[model samples]
Target: MTEVDLQEPRRVPARAAGALRRAAPALLAYAGVRALGLLLLAVWSAAKGKSPHTLLTARWDSLWYTRVADFGYGWEVRLPDGTVHSNLAFFPLLPWLERLVSAVSPLSYGDAGLLVSWLASLCAAWGIFLVAELLYGRRAGVCAVVLWAVLPVGIVQSMAYSESLFTALAAWSLYAVLTGRWVSAGLLASLAGLTRPVGAAVVAALWATAAVHVVRDRKLSWRMAVGVLLAPLGAAAYVLWVGHRTGGGLFGYLDVQGQWGNGFDGGLAFARFVGDKFTSFPSALAGLGLIVGVALVIWLYVLCVRRGQPLALLVYCGIVVALALCASGYFGSKPRLLLPAFPLLLPVAVALARLRTSRSAAVLGGVAVASAVYGAFWLNGSGPP
Candidate 1:
């Protein structure tokens, strides 16, 4: 049994009360940080004569999701350059949830989307804590949740976006894998795939771990085989359906992303995007900051590897970083895209766990305030796209 399973008499979440009590501290901290961010955003937006509620629920991708939820796909925006931005690019799971919530409640599509995101953020926090607590200890788990909460882009977690939903699914999936619950892991991974394209990372981790187990131990359970089979179903099903709809076969999704100027270009495009920043004097500092941020991400991944984190986490983190950093377009969205990569913060959390409670609390508190301010400023501007 794993560390988490050791003290537990049961593994399923049927003990909802027990699970909530165990995760209360981390969840509360995460909620507190997000609440601060929301409050700051409201104040900032009020001063600017904008609506914080609109920023969170009706802008950018949130609008696209609400569109998808309100009217099923086939909606396309034809650009001046003839490029087509299609609603088919968005996966179905989030919209589906929004629809479900709207059907059950008095909330409109945007409000339902916001409600779903808020609840998913809590689930993500609880899952992050569980994974960290299992790997290190409860203290490290709490620290990880707080650190994740205080991320400068952490305010995105409160928005009507898929990051929190996807992260919640991915984290719990990884935890299920670690605890030898292969079927549970695969099921969660499948759902995660339906949430975001990075869901493939979760499937990859599951398959890789299952492969390692089979090869090394020369043993495989029926559960393991079933899990391996189930891991990719969500993504595969959607991609295939898109292909069938567009009559482009398997490359339909790629065509959609290409029209959006997004793809895995091995960071060449991203490098050029950063390099262009130095051509002007004022933008050079932003470019430098971007470089430092990328370097910090790389450094943390290296630490996770050197520290011998579980293979599942390494695979998940590596793919997440690679995709977010290497995508050719939407540089501003990189940080938000990387939000679900909670594993990269585990090393930081583990390190912070070494400090005295008072010292760590002070440090995290200061950072939280800074993050809230930054979040307010970020959303008041062009926010995550």
Candidate 2:
């Protein structure tokens, strides 16, 4: 081999070590918050005579993912009330990874799913940090990662759910778009599509950003053209396959979601659901809280726009918030759905970054503890369905 070729292997480790050193702060903060959550969960579960591991790996949608991993689709449960819940409604990427991990290791499918989620959550934090660092600064980037980890619903990041995987793909895809890496963005968007139904947000962001570039330059490079073409194939392929299998034609995927009572009603169903909460005295507070929370979300988006954030971040965050709020089913899942919209926290992160480092650390540390307690309580009760 040439001298250059001989030197390349040594250079690879050097580059990886440099990257790890740079990312260490954000990664460490992410791990600390997650460890806090897990610790609280274990204590609370022990007190309640429940298994924390089961809560993380075997409950709620985790079970659905593991089932899909073990048995490749076509599984359904028909309830006594005549509703059919099909595993086909879920996207396939997470389960595919779970199966791959289990096949190569001694881990069970559930354990594999949890492991995938944990690794993906760390990747998601790194990607979030990179995006923030590109737009703001390193301090803002670290703050953003910490803020994401301390979200009230952050425990889902540690569970065997697709949120972390989908968020990781979405964040990196957005980073790729911001950096003008069209092909990389397209590939990540395609993978995000396979990971979750909301991958449409990533696809839309790619298309929107590409269109802006083309309009401004009055030219489209062949690479960008190819990327735009490749972006939607993953989601389209899976939906088409579902359509063929269910004999529902082009709308098969929608039909499958309909079976689960989920659909996009432009927030009408959500408004009604929130309104109905006011029927009783106790629920009226919840109704008021819902309205305020939604208003805050909208106001934050407005801040993003006014702050002159990139078009890709704006489009992605807007679509994610819209989808989360507009979905008709699972009234309790709105917060978890909105968890991946980390860009919405940029304004907060920026504000935090401007504070003294000691003060910021204190605030973040307190929030992390509170979030851990809440996560434990949530899982011990009626957690995400």
Candidate 3:
């Protein structure tokens, strides 16, 4: 045996050990930081003249979800014209989980919301960590989970919102795809579609990846074709059902949103809405802040592409962001809605890993504390209340 042969054998185990060692520290740090953030959220919510218990149960979106689980989808508020403002418009998975938790726990429908989000967010964090670790290595994965835990939108993770559930499904679904677990990926993609209309983006990414593989090989294998074909049925079936029930075409969902003063074409029109805010000083500053935030989102997406992100993840995040932004309604929820696109967390995580360990930990810790404090205040109907 020559020197070159001995060197190859030595390098393999060394590399493997190095990877395991690098990954373990980041994983431990990620879990610790998130645990602290959650504790802060609970404590802060309690201190603000509100019961953290009630805050879990009584908030606006939480109420709707509880209503859906307690009753069923056909519940609606009607306008004079008889247009159905149905809670059915919301997807079923989160409410289903709420009902499941309530059945097993002593909690009310409201507290169950918190329980579900709390558990789901941790799962989401883990799924995201695994995906990031696979793509950019363990340090980036750790950073991604930490940043996600401290995001300004972190409050919603603790709310009854579907962000955590959606993130878990999307992240793991993508991971399954990356690992070529076709059936698991497709099943997850389908359920994700049922979770939110944008779950269609996950289905699309799955199908596209399979299709690309098929085309590359010049023949469609049954596993690949079936996996690609099966992914979108969940979203399509639900949306079409909404259309049938509402007596609108498949586009009835859009019409329903129109009733709420939302529709897709007007997002660009929102630039003017932001601009007109400048007529007042405080409003001008708010508009500037909004502009800055949107700029950051756009810049992050570009960074993902420039950093040579995997094609499937990039397309998945891109389509989801575009759909969320272009949708005709609920401008206020765009930030929260886009929160599940875990790919957006990647660049921020990469940046965090570059700082000195002490500095990075402090910066991330400070953001988590601030987010927790603000989240508490906001939930209490104080600042941004």
Candidate 4:
């Protein structure tokens, strides 16, 4: 073959092999933790006469996604209380994947969603490890992956949710940005924007990084300018399309979210919700726990800033936290929403990396069991997950 053909064929496999070698250990550990969570969930569901598969694939947001796949959007519920719950509030990427997977295979939409989510979670874990490894080292990367896997809401990573898919896109996009691959970074960010509202964090981070590069170097590269241009297209397209459909113009999507009682309220709604919890002794304890959780999140961000994490990571993480915590919607979903904010775990990962291997493993093992139990309990509870 000619030199050009030979070079193109040889490059891809070499890069894939190198990435596999670098990420193998982290990926293996991540798989192990997820497997344990599934095992515990299965046992718990069996005891309660519930189906584990139903919990993972046919409930809450998963059900909405499958419905969108089965019957293309335009679905809405009008409650007697005068509230509108519309499937249009959900972004289209997950349902599109579910539809595509179901069309190509014998699986149902729910099955396809679960499969896509499980696979995307592996990709997400791998991307997270690569980012941590690039910043710290392989050991810290492994610790970061473990920390994420042992989160109280970690089981959501394995469920038929958009969190895993969005995270995979976000992590890989951040990695691309860190490595100065502008076009790839922008493309990934655009895909992420199509996945979830938090994708704005990725787009903002890319813009912030590119702006810093241009200002510091006193000139803008064509690649950087193109990346910036591509970053917002996914979200803009979807929002504008929704506006056209609703005939409400630019604010149609926001109107839909408002109908569902979801909006950015500067944390006033969330604070009132927490404050109400203090009226009873038992609920006061939960309120105190909420305070501690918020404080911990803030402390970790300060540590990240003091330790000099990359500007892209900080901005991405800051926006994710702000949106999750400040939103006026379901209080129970905040932890799950925060799943994509993996950089907050880095300071913890760094500390874990300093310990002996055996101790670190033991710690992770204990937390993994606790997380599995908590996830099972959380899902089994009467409230929505």
Q: What TM-score would every model get versus the actual structure?
A: 0.96, 0.95, 0.86, 0.96
TM-score of 4: 0.96
Point out where model 4 deviates above 4 Å: 1-14
Best prediction by TM-score: 1
lDDT of 3 by residue, 1-385 (tens): 0111100111122254564465566546555655665576677766655566666566666777889999977777878886656686678888888899899989777777778887787778777876777766666788888888777767777677777888888887887777666777888888888888789789878877776776666776676566776788788888888788888878977666666656667367567767888999989998998789878888989988877676668779998888766665655677777888779888788777777878888988888778776666666663211
Better of 2 and 4 by TM-score: 4
lDDT of 1 by residue, 1-385 (tens): 1233321212445476887788898898888989999999999999999999999999999999999999999889999999999999999999999999999999999999999999999999999998898788888999999999999999999999999999999999988887778888899999999999999999988888888888877899999898888989999999999999999899989888899998999999899989999999899999999999999999999998887778888898999999999989788899999999899998899889889999989999999999999999999997999
How large is the C-alpha RMSD of every model relative to the true structure?
2.6, 6.2, 5.8, 5.6
lDDT of 1 at 223: 91
Candidate 3's C-alpha runs over 4 A off are 1-47, 78-84, 382-385
Q: List the residue pairs that clash in candidate 3.
A: 262-328, 262-329, 263-328, 263-329, 264-328
Summing lDDT over every window of 10 consecutive residues in candidate 4, give the lowest-scoring window: 1-10
Indicate whether candidate 1 or candidate 2 has the larger TM-score.
1
Model 4 pairs in collision:
none
lDDT of 4 by residue, 1-385 (tens): 0111100111122286888788899999999999999999999999999999999998999999999999988999999999999998999999999999999999999999999999999999998998787777788899999899999999999999899999999999988888777788899999998889889999999999888877778898898788899999898888889989988799999999899999999999999999999999999999999999999999999998887788889899999999999999989888888899999999898889889999999999999999999988888774245
RMSD of 3: 5.8
Model 4's alpha-carbon lDDT is 0.89
User: Between prediction 2 and prediction 4, which has the larger lDDT?
Assistant: 2
